[model samples]
Target: MIFQPTYLDLLLSGDLKKRAADFQRRLKACDLCPRDCGVNRVEGEIGFCGVGNQVWVNSYGLHFGEEDPLRGWQGSGTIFFSGCNLSCLYCQNAEISQKVSGSEISVEVLANVMLELENRGAHNINLVSPTHVIAQIIKAIYIAAQRGLKLPIVYNTGGYDSIHTLKMLDGIIDIYMPDMKYSEPEISGRLSGVPDYPSVNQIAVKEMFRQVGNLVMSTQGIAERGLLVRHLVLPGGLAGSKTVLEFIAKEISRNTYLNIMDQYRPAYLAGRHSEINRRITSDEYQVVVKEALRLGLNRLDKC
Candidate 1:
């Protein structure tokens, strides 16, 4: 089946532009993420994410390191947005997320980047760490769609999202790839600096699933639309992988495309915490994977 991007329909209906404008207006108060920073980003007021009106892009290119469905044969077109709403203590991409290293560009240039990635034969436009920059991204998508950018958009988030902002993105985004960081609020707060992560993340995931149901793939195995959940297996069960898996199986969907990642290593300030000071053991990874399977989550990513 030929897959058309959801944003194209919104663009035709003129809702895309309206939504873009509303999202742009949000930058004034900047309640884009769960942070509710309320800083006037339009007037160059830096919020928790440290970004203003202009979109700051760390890098843009085809990335094959993503999930199989997203990467496919052509690779997923990734735009790594600098700065993040949640500060994960063990974040591997600390240079970009925490320090916010990138060049600021106009919405037109951001749109052009999307077009360039599509021209390079990317399966989808994956916006990495996008929760804080929703307004900027929405405006860029509006411009990109006007300039003939038709690739499926992937909202690759850290899961600490605002339902209001996500409601604005209902039909605009195609694939919703979010990380289910922790099932415990205390663990999340201690590790990611977000005390309300569990509740916020769960709500965001449910909203994402409501927008786009289960994973839909093309004959060539590229994701067209879906909610793909990622849970990095942390050392000493700090991630609460079992409970998270159960939630996915019960609340989300038993067939949810889950990536039980084993790539957790002590990066950033992880060494400060004894429990998360080292890489996850092979046994630890297996335990989580076993629980996921036990929960009847069949669509586990073969990584």
Candidate 2:
């Protein structure tokens, strides 16, 4: 790889190891995400995310369904961590996220998965739903970096992250692909079970942009580093898509790489909320995209 991942520098300087150890220690109380579930994860006590000390992985493989830059010809290496900080009413991946259906594995196995994906020619290691397991992921990254894992680490999240956790990952993660789910706190509360999602997500997204700036791609069109935001348009304007786009364009960056997703279908508990129990129309999708462009956010990803 021409573009070396930033974690290697940390690994060489021994900071990666230190961070890993620090994260491991935090498991005693486990305040990693915004939920602040102070359960003793090290003692196998499940918290709000239904996660314990060990890393729970549902699956791992090359995923082409990601944004174009992240998924090139080789595909993005996705390690689907099975648990989440938020319980979205319309959760698309409810089977895994809500139920927490995955096997608990050691950090060594997670590191091996990273190395295996790297050897398989994956362009990047994508950590799906990783907010709850940041400490374990960092520990695994430290291990994998020592074992010749060179691909950029993609921190794919739902944007309900804590500032403390994001601050700890300043130089470790390369690509920060986070979802700006909602702008209205009430909508977020009703749909996602997080009343403060708007405030928390906005702050987390801004921090992600600050950490990595705009998306950068290699000559081969594969993402090397930086922040990529995804905003899924919900039916009937429930997601407050316009205000969410406005935040990205104004508060974050006009040059920010954004994906205005339209593939929102009623899934999981979405049927309960009648307003969001249908797919978004083409007009609904296009209007948000046009508004984003009008706001001068031209770096749109055709996902």
Candidate 3:
């Protein structure tokens, strides 16, 4: 293997271990995510995320469908954590995110899973929907980094993050893949059921961008560090792609990598709603993509 410093080296620096410990301590009282449920997860209390004391992972494997930079020759070491803080009406991974369909795994086992991914030639460790299991993930990262795990770590989140908790990961996560889900609060609340989501996600995404700027890649084009913003274009512009792009252009850097996705399909509870019970129109997606380009967002993902 190449002589590379473990990803944790950057993250666990400057008393980050103490921050992790303190964050873990708070989870017992459990105000981990933005919800501030305070359910005492250490005692097996399930909060808004439906995750209990232990970490429940749905699957861990090499995923090729991610952005090109993330999926080099070898795929991303994708660990799909079960349960999500927000249950969007049109959620694609409803089975795992909503139902929390996975067996509980110990931190040691989770660390081994990271090792197995590295052994299988994965380019990085990608944590999906990791809000509830941040503590366990951090602990496992500590364990894996000590045992020769040196791959970059990716924090793939839904933009619903706790500022305090994210501060603890300042140097630990190399790649930040956050979704700019909505730009309007009412739309976000109606679809994703998160009140004041625009302000919430904006603050959280700003923090992510502050920690890691634009997407940086290895000489081989694999992601090493930086930020990649994903915005899924929903039907009727309900996902608020236009406003999200504008915010990216105005608030964030214009050079930031923006992924305007067209892969929206009515799933989960979306079918139960009138405006969102169908797939997004091709015109709708084209308009948003065009808007992104007109706004000088060049780093778009076609796949």
Candidate 3 versus truth, CA RMSD in Å, comes to: 1.9
Error of 2 at 240 (Å): 0.9
lDDT of 2 at 284: 87
With a 3 Å backbone cut-off (N, CA, C), the pairs that clash in candidate 2 are none
RMSD of each: 0.8, 1.1, 1.9
lDDT of each prediction vs. the true structure?
0.91, 0.90, 0.85
- Deviation (Å) of 1 in candidate 2: 9.2
TM-score ranking of the models? 1, 2, 3
> lDDT tens digits, residues 1-303, model 1?
688988999999999999999998889998999899999998999988888888789999999999899899989999999999988989989999998688988988999999999999999999999888888888999999998998999999899999999999999999999999899999999888899999999999999999999999988888999899999999999999988998999999998999999988899998888888999889999988888888888899994
TM-score: the better of candidates 2 and 3: 2
Residue 60, model 3, lDDT = 89
Q: List the candidate 1 regions with Cα displacement exceeding 4 Å.
A: none
Please give, for residues 172-267, the per-residue lDDT of candidate 2 as tens digits: 999999999998988889888898999999999888888998899988788999999988998988889889888887899889988889889999
Scanning candidate 2 in windows of ten residues, the lowest lDDT window is: 294-303
Candidate 3 structure quality by residue, lDDT tens digits, 45-107: 889898887899889899999989888989999999999999798899899999878778998
Please report the candidate that would top lDDT against the real structure.
1
Single out the weakest 10-residue window by summed lDDT for candidate 1: 294-303
Ranking by lDDT: 1, 2, 3
lDDT of 2: 0.90
